[model samples]
Target: MAYQSLRLEYLQIPPVSRAYTTACVLTTAAVQLELITPFQLYFNPELIFKHFQIWRLITNFLFFGPVGFNFLFNMIFLYRYCRMLEEGSFRGRTADFVFMFLFGGFLMTLFGLFVSLVFLGQAFTIMLVYVWSRRNPYVRMNFFGLLNFQAPFLPWVLMGFSLLLGNSIIVDLLGIAVGHIYFFLEDVFPNQPGGIRILKTPSILRTIFDTPDDDPNYNPLPEERPGGFAWGEGQRLGG
Candidate 1:
């Protein structure tokens, strides 16, 4: 009975979130089981270009170090924000969400070339949180019951928390930079005077992943702030 209930809950998660989170968990599990090593998963330009180790590009964004507090923390944030974004702003727009993933990953890969970072899964998670926070600016958020703020400040809060833990702020900054670039291109710049939409979801992606929604009056994210709250009500960091 417990297994059946868990299965139902798992099925409730959006497809993109489910797939990405599962991949991260499984990759970490493989390392824990000695099936793979972190050395094989870390990003390396030389191995990728000269030795044709192209899988490193994707794997680097999969493993988030060993299974511990840090790994669990990252996984929770990754699954939560990814699910919320998919089910909220990107609702019925699977292809566009997938496109965002690809766009962020591509930019991070380019930036990775210039940085000393090995794994990028945490940065990718921050990118998701940043994009979601931007799209839901009015949502009230509580971080670990210590700080309360609006959604837009989430990435920074996470970064600050990372700094408190003595982790370098470079990874968080990289994610925020990529996320900002994407947000500016997709949302902000397109709405400015004489600005045009620059980041378009590819039609092939539409055909492949997007299901046509027939409702013409559909609201991807309805701004219903009952009791002065948004979709993230009663949720908090590490809760």
Candidate 2:
């Protein structure tokens, strides 16, 4: 059946992105179905420590809310850029990608303690967008087909858009901050003069997610060719 085939194709998305998106969808559906409540899933340090509701740590980053425009928008962006990053810069580096997720999530959680943020799914999405945007600095993006800017400015643009939507910019700012930290430590700093790599991916993670002989024939797709108008332009020039 077409539906089954489509499902199968979607299931073939890179592991980390696929898993994260699936978690978000399922959590949202559960809440919409009234099977779970946001209060139960939100991050609460006291509940996590005293009542042992540690699942909140992960769940808080899973549900964005019941099915709606904001949820859909976040999910689409999450899936698209997460997949692009995995298949582009991280083509064969599954362990490194996983480590980035771990690092970002850990940092966000720490920041959440000081802030009043309950759900961090949006922030996590922003972190992904920020990392992807930074790594692909040359990529050209069009915001609602009205504004054009290079990739590095994408996160800030999103923050401004969030402000326009009357959403708190705190979550977006948290994501951007965490993302910049990761980018600086993992990508930027190590390449600096006399700078050594401080954020090495763990060997155990490498062993599990990355194999020596995996996908020998795999090759990353070319960056999105720039030019021409398209819906939600997020592409690079040339094939």
The best candidate by TM-score is 2
100-215: candidate 2 lDDT, tens digit per residue: 99899999999999999999999998998898888988888887788888889988988998999999999999999999999899889999999999999999998999977656
Q: How displaced is residue 8 in candidate 1, in Å? A: 1.4
Task: Report the lDDT tens digits of candidate 1 across residue range 26-47.
Answer: 9999999999999999999999
By summed lDDT, the worst window of 10 consecutive residues in model 2 runs over: 216-225
Please report, in order, the local distance difference test score of every candidate based on alpha carbons.
Answer: 0.86, 0.86
How displaced is residue 28 in candidate 1, in Å? Answer: 0.4
Name the regions of candidate 1 deviating beyond 4 angstroms: 213-239
User: What pairs collide in candidate 2?
Assistant: 226-236, 226-237
> Candidate 1 at residue 188, lDDT?
95
